[model samples]
Target: MIVRPRPNWFRMLFVWRGSVLPVILPQLIGTTAFAILVTVLHGRVFAWKIPLNFVPFSLIGLTLAIFLGFRNSTSYARYWEARTLWGTLLNETRALVRQALTLADAPSDVPTLTARLIAFVHALRHQLRTTDAKADLERLLAPQDCARVQAARYKPAMLLLMAGEWLADRRRAGQVPPALVQAMEVPLGRLTEALGGCERIAGTPIPFTYSVIIHRTIYLYCVLLPFGLVDAIGPMTPVIVAFIAYTFFALEALSAEIEEPFGTEPNDLALDAMSAMIEATLREMMGEAQPQQPSGLPPGGFIQS
Candidate 1:
């Protein structure tokens, strides 16, 4: 959702400012304490210092770099998949409107089909990510269909079925021509595909084992970093460790947040706003007046259309 490219410094310190604190705090404390312990042990007791070798540190750093890269790449894949599914939704909505206009011209069927299209958009919004939405749905659906969909377990799928039923009814009434029915089916099939894509992204994830490995590796590296640096850096160990901790831990937490792009997280894709765009565009195609602008912009400055 955050598409604008910010400066690298702002990204490190402010882009994820609040979230980074929680993730990096414990690592910072541990690293600092370990550094102090190493310094004290070397000066007061051992009277000898341990030297850190750059070759091993470089190897570890390279490995960590690869791990972070893989994590980010995986997270971005999920984000982009969500974006693609919504894009398909947009194209399908437009196609559905064109099919309706070309195939059927009955005044009675027009309003019914129009309302159903709006209902479909609202239902998909609730269905994909959360269970807390029904307000917009209630506004778009008829009392009977709205009540029925509300009672059903899957609101979006129910609405899709409703659309199918409407199309079938119109076909029976000779309202929709055979050619138009076939064209309409194309968009409906795509709608189904989009639903499946969202569900897949929501249900499946990168293996838990891989996530565990990343976390463990980061923890171990942070913990061992103090041991490697304390003797050479002395009191500077804490500051250096904290910086390293911030870099690795923040990356880990951010990747974890982005891995699931449907939720209401700060960085997740803007599915709600995207669905609203679909609804608005479909409504316009139905010859309805546009919805009034809301007070605030969508979250994360992400415009759906």
Candidate 2:
């Protein structure tokens, strides 16, 4: 994700890094050229006039805009829900660790719990992004624990199970009170719930047929728009068509990019940064040195802005 200060409105017009304009630039150019051709021909096809006017185009454009708006809205909802899940994860992990850290510090339960918590965060992130979690699991987990989690198909769930078993052992050893164990288990349960939510979002996507129909409709609308507008807008059809195409194309591109919020796209959720933050903060809580992230990982926990 591209994080930076919000530019002034005047500068925002040309800001490129975080915008979808670049992604849709090719489509915009093609539509603009096609519009220019239609304009030059005066909505004609070598002496055959294409009978078109703004009437039909107006109705179609309105309907297309509505569809685009609804689609983008749905995509953004997914994006926001994903962010909320991560935020919930950070909170739950912190609560779990905090509860453990306050307990009997003699038997070293804090480190085990903290490692599992952090591992759960990374595992969920990797699973959502469909990336290998071996490096992260090894870096954060003990040999046996890492091996066990690696062997499991669902790593996050495995980590949570390990943590639960750890708590059960703590209670069995009489080091932690039953009441405290039950309280600490709350966060773990919440973590499991959040995991299910993330999995649901990742597994389910915008309907394929809806996406295909909307995609085809948007492009077709843009292509046919020039014919209808050239008859009325005359020489200005290219500019008008380009502007309109830019709007539709940009929205569609943005919707697609953010629809899979767990992706590594520029507009997708900043899972790496977020995971780094969760790890760093938890390490601080456990009094561990803030070590450098492993190779191929981003350095800072904070997203600069």
Candidate 3:
């Protein structure tokens, strides 16, 4: 997510910061060479007439537009779902803290509750990244419980159960009245729902058939482009083809990058920064020493959904 005040076209040129180059460079090189070949060999090794009628090309363009539109819509929906889930997590963390501190008998238990809440956030972040949560959990939870919870594959889910147990124990001990517990329970239920929603998007993706169709369509369009313009465009075919290729391929690659917002990619949502925010907010609610605000997200067209 390169965050510039204005769009940075230069970033798209000769930019080797991450994974995009490997995909874009090849398309650029191939498109450039193909354009040159068509120009130099036009009306020589082959007839320079357009391979397909403009009418057929127009139909293909319309079809490609529709497919790309659909792909982007689906991708954006997944990205939005992930962001929305995190938003719910943020509000839920705040609610959980308020409920615990305001309604619980042992206000001293506030710190422990805060710690557990922070750990749950860290656990959720790690779960999304599919990484180990040992250190984070330990920092945010009691040591023994942290080790046990971190050992699980679904750390966030495990943490949720641990949270329920703690709440149940407190209720059984008459620490929290039934009505107050119900308020906390409502938010907890929402958090669980959010968790499932995020997991569903993460685990399931746009159908393979749609992906295959879009990919094939893009390739077919690019490959057919050179032939369509060779007759009229002649020596300019390569330049035109290369530019069109760049436009189409860049859009395709960008859509793929944005489709999965949980990734560590610079362009993806700043989940790490977001988790830190939740931790800071929870700790502040517990009256702990505040951690410094995290760095801002990089400038990009779409950092979040």
lDDT of the candidates, in the order given: 0.74, 0.87, 0.76
TM-scores, one per candidate: 0.84, 0.94, 0.88
Model 3 lDDT per residue over 12-79, tens place = 56556544656788888987797687667663444635455346667887888888888888788888
lDDT of 3 at 269: 71
lDDT minimum window of 10 residues, candidate 2: 294-303
- TM-score, prediction 1: 0.84
What residue pairs clash in candidate 3, if any at all?
1-266, 1-267, 1-299, 2-299, 2-300, 3-298, 3-299, 3-300
Cα shift from native, residue 65, model 1 (Å): 2.5
Output the better candidate (1/3) by TM-score.
3
The candidate maximizing TM-score is 2
The true-versus-predicted C-alpha distance at residue 299 of model 3, in Å, is 15
Q: Candidate 2 on 1-305: residue-level lDDT in tens?
A: 87666688899989888899889999999999999998888888889998988898889888888888899999999989988889889899999888887765444768988999899999999999889999999999999999999999999999999999988888888888988988988888999999999999999999988789889998999999988888677999999998889888888899999999999888888788788889988998988887565344444433443
Give every collision pair in model 2.
none
Best-to-worst ranking by lDDT: 2, 3, 1
In model 2, the Cα lDDT at residue 277 comes to: 82
